[model samples]
Target: MEIKIIVDAMGGDFAPKEIVLGAIKALKKDRNLKIILVGDEKLINPLLEQESSDLNVEVVHTDQFITMEESPKAAIKEKSKASINLAMQLLAENQGDALVSAGSTGATILSAAKFLPVIPGIERSALATVLPTARLHPGNHGISLLIDVGATLHCTAKQLVHFAYMGSYYVSHVLEIPRPRVALLNNGTEETKGGEVLVKTYRYLKEAPNLNFIGNIEGTDILKGTADVIVTEGFVGNIVLKTLEGASEILKHAGRYAYRKRLTWKVGLALLSSGVRQLKKRTDYSEYGGAPILGFKKLVIKAHGRSNAKAIANAIGVARQSVEQNIAEHIGDSIIEFNKQHRLDFIDI
Candidate 1:
């Protein structure tokens, strides 16, 4: 099956250059992949002419753009023809199988939710990102999904459980993880720890026969390969993500400072530079490209604002995988079964 991807060329900081280069790279790698770059054609086409390739890439002209500081609702309401909006519209119309953008995260979420909608019974959508964990057991060396990394600010106990279910389904189908284990982020491994929400969510998860609930996991457990899926509200998850990013930056700065301090330390730094680069690569979310807005009608990936060509290419790869896995169909089916077995009306509050 040919995979069609729509790229919002004007969505990110680098605009057409990074997006166009990424599309070119993806097309060069995957012959069956087709990409539609949505942006101002005048600027994009001239740039593409310089590439001088026979790749399967086309441009769709869109004059509207949503800025980072603009209100999401206001931008969508005023600029109906925005590049992000049109890219999503193309996805809905089946003009493209998936959409990718290194645009405003808030605008991306709001536009995707409003235009693509969510699977029935899914109260809200989440941004799920894959993270690398310490390899403990065989077949556990790959990445795992972290839900609500930066989406829903607050959630109920039931909603967290629902996030777990959705995360499990995503890991199973899209990531090909069989019987994925779900865990709640907590300060301790004991069931008695955490706040009221975590306690209630832990109890509810225990009753979910379909999921492999692994009790509570501490913050350190996340990097130790303790569970395949970690569920938490956006507030805490966002803090963890940002802190990791900040710590990485601090480490890089410290390495440079040490390297400049003395000759012996400079030699040591040179010896460890490769290892440091590898460590940074593993911890960086840009390598994963973007987080998918799970439960949406169409595959909508939100890339980082500082995304480069590599990140954009990775996002395209994720979109292609999601399409091949039939993620939308799987979410729809799972919601139906969940609703049939449980009364969702009482929990919709």
Candidate 2:
């Protein structure tokens, strides 16, 4: 299948430059891929001209640009022609199979919800990202999916169970896992631990026939790959994500410092450079490209606002793989089945 990715070229901190460069790189790799660059035509055309070879790429000019400082709802209302908005529009219209943006997360979520909307029976779309884990368990060598990483702040037990259903389907389809284990992030292993919401969610998941509920998984268990899918409210998940990013940055800086200290350290660095690079790649979100706004009617990928060309390219790759995996359809079916079997009133918000 020919995958078409619509990009918000003027969305991020570095506008058309990073977006355009990423498109060029993706075009070089996949001849069947088509990219629709949505942004200021004048600015983008010149950048494209500078490149020696332009592959399967096209431009869709839009006048409005949504700034990071602007409110998401307000921007969606006023700037219908904004790059992010237009990108969503193109996806809704079936002009592109998937949409990618290094723009405001709020704006991307709001606009995508407005235009493409969430799948039927989906409470809200959640942002799902991958985390590196030990290779001893299921979903170990590759990556584990964490949902609602700063999307829906307040969630009910039913909503969290739904998150597990969607997240598990994603891991199974995209990551190629047969039966992904789903675990709720909590303080302890006992079912009695955590807040009332988590406790209730645990009970619900425990009875879910489709899901492989592994009870509660502590923070320490995350790196051990105890579960293939980790479900949590956006608030806690976001904190975990930021903490990991900060720790990775600190480690990189320490490695740099060690490399500059002495001849022996330099020799050690030389020997460990490849291993360190592999570790960095494993921990890096950019390597996975972007996180999918799962449960949406259309495929909407939210890239890092500060991502470079390689990150954007990787996100496009993710978008393609998501479509191929039929992630949206799988999530939709799972949610429908889950909702029918379980009573919605059981989970009081």
Instruction: Give residue 171's error in model 1 in angstroms.
Output: 2.4
> lDDT, candidate 2, residue 166?
86
RMSD of each: 2.2, 2.2
Q: List runs of model 2 lying over 4 Å from the truth.
A: 50-54, 136-139, 261-267, 344-349
TM-score between model 2 and native:
0.91
lDDT of 1 by residue, 1-349 (tens): 7899999998888887888888887787888999999999988888788875787888889888998889988998899999998888888788998899999888888878777867777787888878888887565755778888877989888678778888998788777789998999989988878888888778778877588998998898877787899999999888887886787689879888988999999999889889878877887777876878887778888888888888889889888888898887777776666656667533643
Where is model 1 more than 4 Å wrong at Cα? Answer: 136-139, 344-349
- CA lDDT scores, all candidates in order: 0.83, 0.86
lDDT of 1 at 298: 81
User: Number of the top candidate by lDDT?
Assistant: 2
Return the TM-score for each candidate structure: 0.92, 0.91
